[model samples]
Target: MTGAKELDRFLAELTTERRLSPHTVSAYRRDVGTLLEFCAREDIESLDQLAVHHVRRFAAESHFRGLSPRSIARRLSAVRTFLAALVEQGRLTANVAVHVQAPKPSRRLPATLDADQVASLLEIKADDDLAIRDRAMLELFYSCGLRLAELIGVNVADVDAADRTVRVTGKGAKSRVVPVGRLALEAISRWLRVRATLVKGDEQAMFISRRGKRLAPRTVQARLNHWARVQGSPTRVHPHMLRHSFATHILESSGDLRAVQEMLGHSSLSTTQIYTHLDFQHLAHSYDEAHPRARRSRRRRQKTK
Candidate 1:
């Protein structure tokens, strides 16, 4: 089979069988396309002909072409997946790309808003229909730590006010029920009251446009930023920032790694550990309060004073 045909079949399987998200599939397509280009340049007609040296050269060339370590890593991963598929189908003897290592991606901590900033951001008055809707959206976002896609995909039935919980479908289409804070629940209740006025049809979406369609991801982002400006925010507020704040604040206060992981729907504890990094002042306070040596040192300083 032609390499192109092989990629098409793999992508189709990824879509239907694996149920990978569109963004993830698109990325795989792009990264694999780059590999094909490299293979063409190397006079390779089939991925079955690929060797370890060829993959090494491809990685080196990608790095020389100004691809960042993280990007190169992702591309390598895509190539590995494609080759592995080929091997599974008996197109190749082994997956050569597996031996090639990608550089470790730098771990940049996610940005988060402090409690005061979050309060200021969420203090939108429900004076109008759109305001009520936006208020509900913002409240749910921060309250639940929902991904923008997850928030956009919320249905009318997903939010259970009686139970004070929301059923969120996260990455990999994994669904989890997370608690809804009182403020978020109340805001949603208010929005539900006036929601019918803007809805045009039997839209089951929890958040809808004036035309009564499910709210688009772009619209959610624009609305969030628009409210941020109106609220006189210092920085541009995105949906993920609210999620970051939710996780950070929750971790800081509760100090429960496993709990935060479950609430965030993170499949790994390592992903949740990023929130363990507290502000320097918070760290200092913790040290002073919890460390026996620090307490003795403080007592000595106090005696000297």
Candidate 2:
């Protein structure tokens, strides 16, 4: 009957009925709670009393307050989900939030290093044992297009050096067999051979810290940053940058969008299309150089010979 009671019930439904994760439920709770606060300030009391105008006004206020389109969209999605739950439970006659569309987010392309920079990064050598491991890490990240979590989460048994492939368990626990290049395979083999020296009898993971324990994502990130600087790259590098470069390079060379999609483990082909833009840029440059019309005479045709 009351607003607080209705909100509590809706949140319960979100967790118990909708089966949302705890993190997701917490985010939705925060967003919906903010909306309720705004409703209170505007003297609106109950779920049944809520209107589409209230939602529009809240969005306008959020935009005027300098909230990014992405943040506002996320918040609005939370509200819409909450309202849908309320409507399903008979707390409201209809879902009003559905009528208003959220703002579209800008699609910014990810930055990737060129082939030369990648070569420089992977070719740098050092004598230290950890240096070897870092090399292997970057190589695999770029070589296989692995996510940071997938790379660090690799177990010893997952790698198949004889076959030049590794079994990666990616997002949603989906497993895919990815081929490793010769350079990456060599680096990994070297690391494995000497791994026992650094980490004796640790069989749980493929890569570990100096303490013979599995490496954390942050440590991997820090090591990459250190090497990126040492290699004189213009910008700071992370594991994902290597992965992006891998996808971009593979797409440029093969032009097989489907293969790249499979390698990246993207569920949607649309998500993989961003690399096509990079491919297009490459094509444009090639056309400018190779096409006869694109290469003009240095002297202007002698003014109508």
Could you give candidate 1's per-residue lDDT for residues 80-188 as a string of tens digits? 9999988888888999999898766677888788899999999998898999999999999999999999999899899988899999999999999999999999999
Candidate 1 residues lying further than 4 Å off, grouped into runs, are 1-67, 71-100, 278-305
| Winner by TM-score | 2
Separate clash counts for every candidate: 0, 0
Local distance difference test scores for all models = 0.90, 0.86
Residue 54 accuracy (lDDT) in model 1: 92
Give, for candidate 2, the lowest lDDT window spanning 10 residues.
295-304
Q: In model 2, what lDDT does residue 87 have?
A: 80
TM-score of each: 0.66, 0.73
Give per-residue CA lDDT, model 2, range 19-122, as digits (tens). 98989888977888888888888888676788889899988888888888888889898888888877887777898889776677778888899999999988
Candidate 2 stretches greater than 4 Å from native: 1-66, 74-95, 285-305
